[model samples]
Target: MKLRAYLLMLAVVGIWGCTFVLIKDALSDASPLAFNTVRMTLAFLVLAIAYRRHWREINRHQLIAGVIVGFFLAAGYQFQTAGLAKTTPSKSAFITGLVVVLVPLFSTVKALRPVGARAPRWNAYLGAFLAFAGILLLTVPAGSGVLPDFNAVNSGDLLTFGCSVAFTLHCIALGHTSPRIAFQPLALLQIGFCALFMMISTPILEHPQMRVTPRLILALAIAAVLATAAAFSIQSWAQSILPATHTALILTLEPVFAWITSFLFLGERMGLRPASGAIIILAGIAITELIPQPHVPTSHEA
Candidate 1:
C-alpha cells in the first residue's frame, strides 16, 4: 500500500512537472482564462465519458459543492497559467508549494483548534525548511537587472500564488465531499464549473484575441487530459488513505519536479541560487510539519 501510494504520487508529480511548460506554451495562443476553461472542458469530457453511470449518483448538494470547488480550481489554474508567462518555472513551482504550509492553518480555522489534535511532526518541518530555502536561492536573480515588472507582475508567478491558495482550500473541501457521490461525477461537475468561470472571465479582463493553432490545441489537450485528470485522480486516491499532512508534504515536491522537467524540455533553467532557495522552502515547510505531531490519528478521528 505504501509503495502504491508513493508511486501514485510520483506519477502525479511527473504529469504536473510537464504542466508548467504546457501552460506556458498554451498562453501564446489563448488568454489565461480561455486556456483554463478550454482545458477543463476537455477534462470534463474525458471524465464524463468514463463515468456515465456515476452521474445519477451525484446529488444536488454534491453539484453545488462541486461547482464551488470547481470555481476555485479554475481560479487557481487561471492564475498559475498567467503566472507561467512571466515567471520562471522554478520560481513559480516553489511559490506554489506554499499550499503545503497552508493546509493545517485552514484545518485549524475550520475546527477552532490545531489540526491532528496535536503539534506537527519534526521531520515534516525539516523537509519544508529545506524546500523553501532552495526556492529563495532560486528566485534571487543572478544579477541586479532581474527585477520583476511591477505593473503586470510576473503573470505566471502571481497566478501560481493564487493556484496554491485555491488548491489548499480545494483539499479542505475534499474532506467534506459526500462518500455517497462518486469521484468522477463530482470532479466532472467541478470541471464544468471551472470552465464556465474561465470562459466568462477571459473575455472581460484580457480581451485579447486568440488565434489557435495545432500546437495550442495539442498543449491544451495534454493539460486537460493528462495533467488535470490523471494527476488529480492519482492524488485523490493516494491521499485518501494517507495522513493529510503527509500527503500534503509529499505534494510539496511538485515545483522541484516541474523545475527539473522544464529545464530538460522547455529550456527553462534554474541556477544554483534559486535551486538552493527551493531547498530552503522545502526545509521550512518540513519544519512547520515535523515540529508538532503528537501521535497517530485514530481512524474514527480521521
Candidate 2:
C-alpha cells in the first residue's frame, strides 16, 4: 500500500511537471490570476460533480481543514503562475523545487503538529540536501555556475519563493487532514475552496483578462482536469499514507520531468551537468528510502 502511494505521488508530479509549459503558453493569452481562477474553478466544478454524493459527509473539522489547505493551495498557485510570467522557466522551476527543503523545516514547527507535521528523519534531511543540490544543477543555466546570482534577485524569484513556502504548508495540511476525513469530501472541499479563493482574489490582485484562444482552452482543460482535479485527488490519497517530507522529496522530480518535457516539446537539450544532477537526485531518493530509520519511543513508551 505504501509503495502504491509512492507510485501515485510519482504520477501526480509527472502530471504537474508537464504543466509548466502549458501554463507558460496559457499565460500569453490570459493574466496569471485570471487563468488560475478559471483553471481552479473548472477543477472544482469537475470534482463537485464527480463527488456530488459526498458533500453531506463533510463536517466542521473537514471544513476547517479544507479551507486552510485550500488557502495555501490557492496562494501557492497564485505565486507560481505570477512568478512564471516574470521569470525564466529554469529559475522558476529551481525556486519552486525549494519546497523539498521547506517541508522538513516547516514540519518542525510545534504549531503545525495538529496538522500531522513530523520531525523528518536524518536521512530525509540528507536526501533534501542532495535533491536541492541536484535541482540547482538541473535548473541553473550552464554559464551561470551552480549558485544563483543573488545580486540579480527579481520580483519573480521572490514570488516563487513565496510559492515554495505556501506549498510546504499545503503539503503538511493535507498530510494531516487526509487521513482523518473521507477522501471524496476532503478532495472536493479543497478543490472547491481553492477555486473560491482564487476567484475572490483575481480582481483584487490584477486586471483579469483572457483571450478565448484554442491554445488557452487546451491549457485550461489539461490543467484543470488532469493537473488540478486528478492530481490533487491522488495527492490527498497518497499523502494519507506518506509523510509530508517523503512526499516533498518525491516531488523534487518535478523539475526533472519539466526538463524532460521541455526537451521533448521545445527542443531544449540537457547538458552533462543536468544529467549528473538527475542521477544525484535519484541517489538521494534511494538513500532516503533504503536507509534504516531510527525508531523513536512514543511518549507512553518513553
Candidate 3:
C-alpha cells in the first residue's frame, strides 16, 4: 500500500509539472484569476458527477476540513497562476517547489503541537536542505553565477514564494484531514470550495478576461480533467497513506519534470547549472528513500 501510494504521488506530481507550461501558454489568452476560476470550476464539475453518490455522506467535519484545505489550495493556485504571468515557467515551478522545505518546517513547528505535530525524521531535514540548494541552483540564470542574487528578486518570485507557503499549508491540512474523511467526499468538497473561492475572487482581484480560442479550450480541458480533477483525487487518497513530509519530498521532482517538459515542448533550453540542480534534487529524494530510519527503544526495553 505504501509503495502504491508513493507511485500514485509520483504520477500526480508529474501531471502537475506538465501544467506549468500549459498554464503559461493559457495565460496568454486569459487573466490569471479568470483562468483559475474556469479550470477549477470545470474540475469541480467533473468530480461532482463522479462523486455524486458521496454528497449525502458529507458531514460537518468534512465540510470544515474541505473549507480549510480548499482555502489554501485556492490561494496557492491564485498566486501561482498570477506569478506565472510575470515569471518564466521554470522559475515559477522552482519557486513553488520550495514547499518541499516549508512542509517539514510547518509540520514540526512547536506551535502546531496541539494539532498532532511531530518532528520529522533526520533524513527529511537533510533532504529538504539539499532540495532547497537545488532550487537555488535552478533559479539562478544560466550565466549569472554560482548563487542567485537575493536583491534582484522580483514581485513574481515573491508571489510564487507565497504559493509555496500556501501549498505547504495545504499539504499539512490534507495530511491531517484525509485520514479521517472519506477520500471521495473530501476530494469533491475541497475541489468544490476551491472553485467557489476562485469564482468569488476573480472579479474582485482582477478584471476577469478569457478568449475562447482553441488553445484556451485545450489547456482548460487538460488542466481541469487531468491535472486538477484526477491529480487531486489521487492526492487526497495518497496523503491518507503518506506522511506530509514524504509526500512533499516526492513533489520536489515537479520542477525537474516541468523543466524537461518546457525544454522538449516549448523549445526552452536548460543550462549546465540547471541540469546539475535537477540531479541534486534527485539525490535529495534518494537520500530520504534509501536511508533506513534509526530504531528507537520501546518503553519496555528502556
How high is each candidate's TM-score? 0.80, 0.79, 0.82
Over the stretch 1-302, how does candidate 1's per-residue lDDT look in tens digits? 97899888767776676677667766788776667767878888888887788888877888888887777677677776777777876677778777666554545454523233544444645555565445445544444457532453344555676777777666555545534456777777877787788878877877655668988888887787877776667776776777756765566677778778778877876566655677778776666655443322111000
Q: Which stretches in model 2 have alpha-carbon errors above 4 Å? A: 1-11, 114-118, 127-148, 236-250, 269-302
Better of 1 and 2 by lDDT: 2
Over 4 Å off in model 1, which ranges? 1-5, 111-155, 178-180, 241-246, 288-302
List per-candidate RMSD values in Å. 5.2, 6.0, 6.4
**lDDT tens readout by residue for model 2, 1-302:** 99999998888788778888778878899999999999988988999898999988988989998899889888999999998888655556656766655555555566664443356678767867786677556545454665665455577767877887787778667657766777788778877898999999999999999999999999999999988777767776776688755765677677777777767776666578767766666666555545432211000000
**Which sequence of candidate numbers ranks them by TM-score, best first?**
3, 1, 2
Steric collisions counted per model: 62, 0, 0
**CA shift of 203, model 1, Å:** 1.3
Clashing pairs for model 3 are none
Alpha-carbon deviation at 13 in model 1, angstroms? 0.9
